[model samples]
Target: MAQECRIPHTVLCPARTPTCQTSPYLEAIRRQLAVRTRRLNDTGALTPGPPTASGQSDDPDTHDGPARPVVQLLLCRYLAEHAVEHLRCVAQTRHRHRCPHPIRALTGPAGTWRLLPTGPRRGQLALPDVLMAIYDLGHLPYRGQLRWRAQRCPQHDAAPGAADLALAEWQPFDPLLHAAHIRTRLPHPEARRPGSR
Candidate 1:
């Protein structure tokens, strides 16, 4: 039997009733992008999650996917996202119930993740500078009132100066977004504090 999934702040919100609030296609896209771009080895193999047609090794432990520091950072970010996204947001238990906002933090450390202005204007401070500034480290990606998106996700479609590549073409590369994660993890002064307590 399928177990029931509980979501927080959404108990009052109906499930499977249909709403722009949730779109399966968007979720699918998000997940697909996450898989193709977020999960991979430095050599660009499908090691973090499963093997692709590319002949990379199938792996469940993300940490073992990459050896380079940058690769390690990228893998950690993806692993954290996978962990948070799968959490039970609908649980009634105070300790267990949580939204997805801290996810941003988990995506990377502080400042590593930022909000860009969005509106009809060329450039305006339409959005707040810092969001969900709270939450403990590793407990990042707390669901906020808003969601983060790129020009498109999967970079193959949305990132600038990036080309859209098919799964076959992507057989050996991860997302540039993962680069941001890598850059953030460096011991540089620029590294943002991990977005958690």
Candidate 2:
């Protein structure tokens, strides 16, 4: 529909509009599709109220977009916690459970990163901050399932498949989440499921 409508980023999407595919805009539809597809196991969310052990609610039923404001509040809290968890892990110098959401690579390490069609380095600098807004404002409910852990760094290849093997047994930073790294090979949500492939 994006192509038909003269919008960029639609040639690869191939979905028609006015059919209620899932999002009001291209971005949200894409975001929601990604999170739900990768989460191998989901614990869902809890009802929110005051604060809990993490000092936040576990609610997932609210959001501000297609979902109501309450829904956004619940999802935003969870996503914020996820961002905090990521920051802490990276700071401690521990390799995280490779997220396997099959995303476009954000960067290798920033300054030396390459540019791609999706856009420039929007992730490294303000990903965490932007994530907060994505949930709170975008009302994005696809947080836990968006993994992009399939690492392509040539540095890791010296081990020759060792990194992939290690990830299989390594303890998950957040066992509650089925985190997987994004890679080129993973199944894309927009692709039509094969009759047998």
> Which structure among the candidates has the greatest lDDT?
1
- Write the residue-wise lDDT of candidate 1 on 10-71 in tens digits: 32222223344656765665556555553332223422334568755443312321222221
Query: How do the residues 87-121 of candidate 2 rate in per-residue lDDT, one tens digit apiece?
Result: 11111112455433222123321111111111113
Best by TM-score: 1
Model 1 scores a TM of: 0.16
- The TM-score values for the models, in the order shown, are 0.16, 0.15
* Candidate 2 residue runs with Cα over 4 Å from true position: 1-49, 52-163, 166-197
